[model samples]
Target: MVKNPLKIFMLINCLGMYDWSLSAKYFLNIYVFASTIQNSGSQRHMHFIKKTLNMEIFGCFALTEVSHGSNTKAIRTTAQYDPTTQEFIINSPDFEASKFWIGNMGKNATHAVVYAQLYTQGGQCHGLHSFVVQIRDPKTLLPMPGVMVGDIGRKLGQNGLDNGFTMFHNVRIPRENLLNRTGDVTPEGVYSTSFKDVRQRFGASLGTLSTGRVSIIGMSVVNLKLALSIAIRFSATRRQFGPNDDEEIPVLEYQMQQWRLIPYLAATYVLDHFSKTLFMDLVELQLGLLQNDKSIRQAELGREIHVLASAGKPLASWTAQQGAQECREACGGHGYLAMNRLGDIRNDNDPNCTYEGDNNVLLQQTSNYLLNCITDRHQDKVRIESPLESVNFLEDFKDILGQKFMISRVEDCMDSSVSLAAYKWLVCYLLRESFQKLNQERKSGSDDFEARNNCQLYKNLWATVLQGSKVLERPSWWREFSSYKPTVGSLKSKL
Candidate 1:
């Protein structure tokens, strides 16, 4: 409902700092549930979006099953078409097939966008499809017949959110409930889509999926901002032993303290810029979807955004995780107290590393993206590029890999360009080595799965870090940075 993409994400992110559940409410309503309906559903679903923004209806996204998390294609929840009634029978065949980790379903959501393996009356499984299924009564807040739903109980943090689980026992929804923009079933029991290839349809679907991962990049950045505010502001005021015996100084004045915390501050700025840019890229993708642009470039745009969001979430989450820990430890005993909110920040950030997508597994998506580009360049004899031109620099990988770090003085390293050059070389070097390692496994009779699984141990591409390096520079107010006091409530960038 919020028109500006940047402000929408920023507002959700800042609201998260106040209380994660509050932000999760908007995030689920707008980003995850409604956004999917907007993209993959037709005009009939537009009113759901409006009602959700108006608080008339609440919703949850049901995709991850109890037994399967990220392996979405293998999920067992099924929606079989019954042409006789013009309805889809949604079912959870077993306990493991139940929808798990569903936000808002615990106690509040009145409906869900349930994903199931769609089966036609002819018994052909047509892969995953989204359907709007009402799970709770709007007034009573009780589960509907054949709907099993409840909260997951107290968590380490973000307990404000009623995270829950669900199962459906032959629950039937109208044929029109299906989010049918990508794939739809006729009342006569046939599955059809505008897309000629299943792969193209799947590619179109990634745009809806990538929205969460992309937004989390900004969420993680904001976490770092909060932790940095508490730590840096504390460092600037809380005095300790100084150069002289009688004169105590702020802990921040010490070289060691600065060394430990300053890189994270620098990282915060780098990541902030990276998060915003990645967000804008996703905005461009959604804009294309709005216009219904199905060009090769549009398909490629989804893929490129997917690749960046996949990796950006991990980098931002991990960086915030580390930053939170460092900031907490830097505060010493003061940080351990709950009122200080360090522990809350640390615990809230832990889920970011796992949710949306696991930090480690998502990086492989980036690795695979880079590999596909490399493969296209070599085997297909095509240029390595994207509509975003993110990995287009790989066209000069050979030249970049040929270069060496030649900086010999401390002064030379002060400029961030030195770091960026070294990082470019490192990415190119790691990429070529990873490519060789994967090929070696393949040549050794390893199948696609084995090749990928075996090569997971290898270091991989870092496009997010590439962006981070570009933004990591000394503050223009470095001399006056000692006067840089962070605001208590607002986490605004002075630069």
Candidate 2:
């Protein structure tokens, strides 16, 4: 599985071109479900692996509840420990507690990895815990008793995949059904874990969360590429007004068209590389965790991976959103035609911004990680030693900020090195400014949450936007100029 990350991503990308709904369905069922089972430890879930791999059992992940989407802690579904029966009674107390928008749960999936608040026999709620719950009878193709499941109606797009909702009413399952790799209950109804800190355990339990975001990054790139390919090709072929009475020029010749499309074209290559690099990093982290290699470096690498996934997913998805819109507009009215496929691309890619994690909320995670890094630097707690060296520039933040953009001409501003340097400075400036705003908010009597909320305009938006732009812009500049060769009679080129 570690060796297959790139292959898996490429397959998803290819599948996305044919039909996004198909790719999304397979991605959720195979990638997300398999990742969860793998992370839950094979000792207990090997049977599940065998059944799923053999195609005898289909599964979905049930995490987001009707009342709780992003806030996993607030989900009200309960798995109460029944000590006498040695089972857990999974129940949804109210309508809001039902699991919503679960892929494949509407009609097909036989089981689900359900996340619910676990309560011990003593009435102690043990944060969020995952359990393998049977939602349907595989043989009869009917909903299991006490499991209310059905498809949620139409969506904006990707309608080929069934989005579903589920509610459990006094459903009983064996205690061993719990995904107990992170936390577990004793036969005597005691809750215990190797990790004492709840936050640490939460982090550990998030092993499967990053996989969806990583796949989304790759899928977004695929959508962007598809959009650009159509727009650029059509621009090159379609003709418009020109100087001569009988002559018409291809839209690609227009400066405005090139300016509009080329940057996204450049971004495609840049994000493609970034996504691949991130996929490899994730593969390494997954292997390390699977092997139980609990070194400090591994822990730091995990944090870095999480931060990158959070930031990169939003970056890639938003880029696709804007790029698809541009592609649609650049194609004139024809782009809106169903035959052109741009509208489908736009709608299919839109949900990515909100699904895995809302883009805005995800950006906050990145900003918080950045702020923590800055704090650690100032307090001399830890050196800025990112495994990917993404944050190493923070070490020279002062130097970077002091330097100003010195390009003399518009052409100079187009220079890849100049653009990259400017981007670095932009990120550094935002980081410093955001830190200041957050500190000021705290000083003005706001609590941590309120201060963080208040600083979102400066911290979250700037940090995520600038950092993501820098990531794409740097490689984009390199790929754009590095591969170009000038003809002898052409205008002077930077390369």
Name the top lDDT candidate. Answer: 2
Q: Between which residue pairs do clashes occur in model 2?
A: none
Which sections of candidate 2 miss by over 4 Å? 1-3, 406-415, 467-495
TM-score of each: 0.91, 0.91
The clash count of every prediction, one per candidate, is 0, 0
TM-score, structure 2 vs. true: 0.91
The residue-by-residue lDDT of candidate 1 on 401-435, one tens digit each, is 87866654445555989766776676777778788
- lDDT of prediction 1: 0.82
Which 10 consecutive residues of model 2 have the lowest summed lDDT? 486-495
lDDT, candidates in the order shown: 0.82, 0.84
